[model samples]
Target: MSSKFLFAALGLGFMLASCGNQKSEYDRFYEQDYKDSVSEAVANAPEPAPGTRTPSAPAQQQPAQEVHPGSKLIAGSDCTACHSNQQKLVGPAYVEVAAKYEENDKNREYLIGKILEGGAGVWGQVPMPPHPNLNKDDAGKMVDYILSLNN
Candidate 1:
């Protein structure tokens, strides 16, 4: 083959190979579109404001003094084993629990029973075994601390 013809063929081969390896503009556009869809879905979802309860039910304001006493008991107990203030550990974070229950007084009572009698499937797949050792007062305190996280 002539040198010029050979060089032209080599250049064409290189161009084809590069085009084959590169992502198509359509592929890039779709990937970006998927990401934007997910971001928009999340942004449009309702998010509770900090220190405000979820709007499932209207929450009556409890006196801070009454909540403080129970919170102290919760801090002294074993509720901290599975629950933390900020993040999920063995179980969902106390902050998350508080956020879910904050709107309903009935939720507080129901959670108190769960604490004493242990339950499953409330937060996730993990089962939170009952803590029968905790008395009513202590359990009430833990619930208070859980609620206090909203503050």
Candidate 2:
């Protein structure tokens, strides 16, 4: 082949090779089966009988209370980046955290500390980065807001 034709072919080959490695959005979404598994587990797990109370429903259905003002600061500052009330993002959903820490004051403090100083292995292998910008009071307020998600 002529020199110009050979270079053009090589460049086209390189472009095609790069494009082959790129995942489609659907592929990317499907690759994380863990998310689907977690969601399924939450959905399929047996629920309390009609008369019995369940933790998940009560927390969401309860009337709103005076939410901590500082909680919004924390949420806006960083928490909402990965967490939401209904779905998993980077971290477990807020309801999951609320269920775990509900009725336990000490767990609240521990989690607040975790927020200030990031740690891994608690929720999963994923390490939650420390938020040095968050002071104790603000962190506490965020924790309280998280707990309130149950209500």
Give the best candidate by TM-score: 2
Q: Which stretches of candidate 1 lie over 4 Å from their true place?
A: 1-67
Q: Write the per-residue lDDT of candidate 2 for residues 27-111, one digit (tens) a residue.
A: 5554444445444555565645433334464465334464367455654686766766666778888789888786477887898
> What are the clashing pairs of model 2?
59-150
| Model 2: per-residue Cα lDDT at residue 30 | 48
The TM-score measured for candidate 1 stands at: 0.50
True lDDT of residue 39, candidate 2? 48
What C-alpha lDDT values do all the predictions have? Answer: 0.66, 0.68
Instruction: Kindly give the stretch of ten consecutive residues in candidate 2 with the minimal lDDT sum.
Output: 49-58
Which residue pairs in model 1 clash with each other?
70-141, 118-130
